[model samples]
Target chain A: MDYIRVILTIFWKDILAERRTREILSAMLVFALVVILLFVFAFDLSPETRRNTAAGVIWVTLCFSGTIGLNRTLSVEKDRGGIDGLMLAPADRTALFFGKALTNWVYMLLTALFVVPIYSLFNNTNLFSFTLLGVIMLGTFGYIVTGTLLSSLSLQLRSREMLLPVLLFPVVIPLLLSAIRATSILLEGGSQTELNTWLVLLFSYDLIFLAISVMVFDKIIED
Target chain B: MRNSTKTSLMLIVVDILAASLILTALFMVFYYAPVEVEMGLVQKIFYFHVAAAWTGMLGFLVALAAGIGLLRSGNMKWDIAGVAGVEIGLVFISLSTIMGSIWARPIWNTWWTWDPRLSTALIMMLIYFAYLLLRNGVEEPGRRARFSAVYAIVGFVSVPLTFLSIRLFRTIHPVIIGSSDPAATGVFEMSTRMTHTFMISLVAFSVLFVALFWHRVRLGVKLALFEQRKMEDFTGED
Candidate 1:
């Protein structure tokens, strides 16, 4: 019950701040839309040509915009001493992880939500499939699980803004690649078997890192 | 200070053993390994190629273990060992990757193929290269050790997943002679003498790896001590 409260409190905190500023979400949404526009011009992708290429463009946009929000979100905490205050709280460390992860997940998903409608309007293609949304959830789960921890660590470093992506992109390639591949399968209208294998892999990855970070995060966060 | 001579002696013996085994393995590969009528001399490269990769994997796994050990125990020496293992692993894996490429060029008809295993090996190499870069960016010893240890452990865990995911992707490279598939792609039969030579090469390379790792560890220890002693000298603390 207490853990649930902490998570909700943290989630509410992030939401209120974002509501006040509207900076992070706006930047992420615009960035994602521009990327879609770039994809149209760069590939000469007509509506007819967009179906096959849509999944890749959407994922790429999410990854880039998601990274921007992640960096800014954590930087806000660090700058305002909010992270230090959270550390002083007498609760479990994993709660903090869950809280941050939940909020970041929300930010990424919300970005995707906006991106999808804009993409559909611009490209005139439907991306509202159940299977594709499932892929996004699982993929974004894996991505943010690693990204939240990485962004926290990168915030401590000197070249933080630049370092987060460098430290992250290579390590998280398995998630991104698997997710993209799995998403591609769903977008192609393939059966569950084709999607099941990669989904299983993503589930296992999320489990492994979730456990590891929960255990070791206290160590990393120690002064 | 007194251990330097003994360490050097051990390194020499290991190097000599590695040299003999490599030469004998080459001779047996040419004469006794029984080249396939298909791949001819090119297939001979597979023995050392696989061995180097295995050894590199061994080095990486140990480094990861040492990194975790350092973090848990807070022992500076384990941190040194972790760094040494990663450096040597990086070197051997580089050799393995280059040799794999050379072998692949003739066999696969290209300098590189997105063959799953080979691609994983290349990506793993890049991950550690970033590992070294991370270490370089940190100035404080304690912080560097802690951060690098965390990275090594996380990075190592991700390696197998990366390889498995790629292998799951699609594989075109043939399983070699001694691997599981008897009728696998690029498969061939090996004679007794060739087996003997390959075993010797494995043993020799194992010795060489230990020798190199130990020397590198010693260098790390000495450097740490040097930094500490320099700090003490400046402070006039006995």
Candidate 2:
């Protein structure tokens, strides 16, 4: 119960901070929008082509934007000594992990929330599909889970900003690949049978990585 | 002193054993192991190639375990061992990847395929190579150990994911080279003589892993001791 409060409190603090400053979200949003625009020009795809490739474009953009958001979010805590205070509090390290992950998830999702409507308007496509949202949610969950833990680990280092991607991208490639493929299938109006295997693969990936992160996270933060 | 003597004696025995094992494995592979209907002579490289990869993974797992042990106990010696294991693992991974490439040239006709195992091996190599770089980037001994330990632990998870990530793209891929059942790969058949040779080679490689690990650990201890002495000298505390 206390752990829940701690997590919520941390989450709220992060939310309030972002609301006041709008640093992370603004950067992420602009970056994502730019990436989408670049994809539009570079690929020169028709509507059908864009729809098919939209999943990949969105995910690649999210991954890049997500990394930026995570770095800024953690940097905020580290810079303001907020994380130190949080650590000093009577909260479990897992709570901190969860709190940060949740906050980052919301930020990422919010970025998506803002991104999708604009994407639909600009591309003149329907990204408002419930299935696409489902893919984004599931995909973002795995990304934030792994990304938050790695950001924490990297925060304690000197070349932290650069180190996070180096440590993360290789490990997280499976998530990106699975999410993109699943999303692409859905966007193409594929039947459930066509998407079933990828959905299972995505869920299993999220579960396996979440479990491993939970097991090792204590060691990571024990300093 | 006594430990060094024993280690040196063990090294001699291990050297002899490894030589005999490699030769016997080679002999059996060429003379006894049946040629594959599909891959022919190139399939022979799979034995040594996969053996190298397996040993590399074994070394990586050991490094991860040692990393956890060091953190739990706060022992620098365990940290030293962890670094040594990762370095040796890096070497073996490189050997395996190169051998895989060599074999791929004749078999896959491209000298490379983005095959899952090969791709994963490449990722493992980069992760650990980055592990070493991360260490070099830090100046503090304590912080270096902590960071490297975390990196090693995190890096191991990628090994499996990299090896299998392609399967999510499609399940048409076969994990024949490292499967538990030989028939699954359908590319190679091992006679009894071949099996004997493989066992010998496995044992030999395991010994080599230990010897190399021990030597690296000794170097780490010596370096640490030297630092300690230099610090003491600087402070004039001795």
**Best of the candidates, DockQ:** 1
**Candidate 1: CAPRI quality band:** medium
Could you say which candidate leads in TM-score? 1
The CAPRI-style docking tier of model 2 reads medium
**Per-residue lDDT over A1-223 for candidate 1, one digit per residue giving the tens place of the 0 to 100 score:** 9998987888889999999999988998999888888888899986666877777888889998989988988789889989899888778877887888898899999998998878888866667777778888988887888888877777777677777777777777777777887877876677778678888877887777677677677666787
User: How high is each candidate's TM-score?
Assistant: 0.92, 0.88
The 10 consecutive residues of candidate 2 chain A with the worst lDDT sum are A214-223
Per-candidate DockQ versus the true complex?
A: 0.56, 0.50
What ranges in model 1 sit over 4 Å off?
Answer: A46-49, B1-4, B162-169, B177-185, B230-238
Per-candidate iRMS values, in order, are 1.4, 2.0
Tens-place lDDT digits, model 2, residues B12-76: 78777667777777777788777767877777777777677777888888888988887788788
DockQ of 2: 0.50
Pairs that clash in candidate 1 = none
Cα deviation of B88, candidate 2, in Å: 2.0
